[model samples]
Target: MKHLLLGAAALAVTASMALAGGHSVVRMGTEGAYEPWNFINDAGEIDGFERELGDELCKRAELTCEWVKNDWDSIIPNLVSGNYDTIIAGMSITAERDEVIDFTQPYTPPDPSAYVALDAGLDVEGAVIAAQATTIQAGFIAEKGWTLIEFATPEETVAAVRNGEADAVLADKSFLDTVAGTDGLVMLDRMEAIGGGVGMGLRESDAELRAKFDAAITSMKEDGTLNALIAKWEVASQF
Candidate 1:
């Protein structure tokens, strides 16, 4: 009886550990510069759509999440090198990216890209349109006659346009609408709608975690939590 009791206690401990360790504390990556998606405020803290979404998703998944700011160009490589367990920097789901990292089902669907000008009457046609490298917008810009000023992240692109260093910028419609009220900026025109949507990135081995996140996203969408967030952020027009 004593031996049997000891064996049962050992098995219980092992089972507890397995259950406790099943979920990982995922490190989520973001660009500290993309506004309405993820960006650093004047207070030097990260705030915006993606950050809020990450918080909500973490709550729904019942997992601990850490946010890490990284350059857009390095976001993927960092994921590949195990620097982050996931990325939530308004990253679009694309076949090219799937070749390396796994992605959750897209949470935010893509909207039309738009151009904005800081100065009135700029008369910009061959303006320098900014987009992050390796994005669908980059491919679209490559085919256009306008000068393309590629940036390491969307934050830099917005900054360039605000500083008058670039005539205009091409970005998601939500971002454009968010910046419209800022001094010295006006929307130019909405471009073709890009159909791809944003998703969280995970390592191929972290399929279980990805499944949890996808389920959480689906629930959020179904319960109107995601739409509430978009409304709270004042980005509903992009939908």
Candidate 2:
């Protein structure tokens, strides 16, 4: 749900700094918060499934790439404003977002959406659901006419459910699984698909760059490298 809304561009100057050796930099922006997809490790580096995948794609494309951490809610806007050249974050390939930015052919297929709650008493149809703002999960809650509580980040949404601010949180099952296992949370019996597949977001002007990554992803798929990464991350859903 953490859709990029351009609130400010004060960091544009720093973001536009060039790479050395006359090599064009392909800065990869990610929300370094969500785990298993992309998250900051103890060493203070972006480390996760997307991290590994991004490096592989960059190597295959022969791009001089670097990771850029951006807040999830502003990720898309920063990319549009040139803070980064690509988004290696776990962004879904949705029609609404496609209108604003181009997406590579999906590397991660759409995983099922699940509802996690502290308990089973809340009526999902009428209960207040927590979702990160501007996400498909948030849209789904709104579409169902459920009272939706919006948060700026996924952690905040899950925290809302823990704090009784929401009856449940709707999110990707892989993500919810991590939180549910340790925090006394539980998945409800409701599960569904909300969006298409997950892909890297790119600027519409970066068609050539998108093609490079797409080709690399296709190669990985053909050789089973992509599935290996998915399985390694325990995000086993495949196209």
Candidate 3:
């Protein structure tokens, strides 16, 4: 749960920048803070499951691509504003987001949402839940009428729970798993499945580009390479 809102101003930019020899240079946008999905490594370069997958997809599509790091809250807007051509971040494919931008065929299966808290017996239903703003998890919490605390980043949500600002922090299981058992945090028993699986976000006008990446994703799913990467990164369930 991370990307959801966008403004009409985002529709201003129409296409990506072109490189020499007429080859399209695609700028892949991402929230580089989500580890295992995308993040900055010790070398100060973008490195993670998405970084690897995006590179492979570009090679398969025969497109020259570069990674662009953007804040999670403005990721969608930046993409629509021509700051980037595609969002390779671990964005869930949801109907709400589909109305603003196109999404490629999902590369990863629907990841289960989990609640992590300091106390194992925390009453999640009535407890104050922390979620990244504009994410499906945040929407879900609000829809449930539960006390919801919104944070700008995933780390902030977890921090809220740690600091007693919230009873629990709800987020993707893959992300929670990394922090569980550290700093007295424990994963709760309840798990909720949210959204349709994660995919590449593209502009509606980039149908041709979407097709290229979709084809590449289909090939990966067929050849078992995508599953291999999923297993390697342990981000989500494989296709």
Candidate of highest lDDT:
3
Regions of model 2 farther than 4 Å from truth: 1-23
TM-score of each: 0.80, 0.89, 0.93
- Model 3: per-residue lDDT, tens digit, 1-239? 45575556555545553322344688899999888798899999999999999999999999999889998878888877778889988999888788888999999998889999999998999899999988889988888999999989899999998899999999999989889999999999999878668999987878888899999999999999999999999999888
Considering summed lDDT, which 10 consecutive residues are worst modelled in model 2? 12-21
Off by over 4 Å in 1: 1-24, 118-125, 162-164, 181-183, 235-239
**Which lDDT tens digits does candidate 2 get at residues 113-133?**
889998866578878899888
lDDT of 2 at 165: 88
Error of model 1, residue 38, in angstroms: 1.0
Candidate 1, 37-66: lDDT as tens digits: 788988887889888999989999998988
**CA shift at 182, candidate 2, in angstroms?**
2.7
TM-score, candidate 3, is: 0.93
Using TM-score as the measure, which candidate wins?
Answer: 3
Better of 2 and 3 by lDDT: 3
lDDT on C-alpha atoms for all candidate structures: 0.70, 0.81, 0.87
Candidates ranked by lDDT = 3, 2, 1
Model 2 scores a TM of 0.89
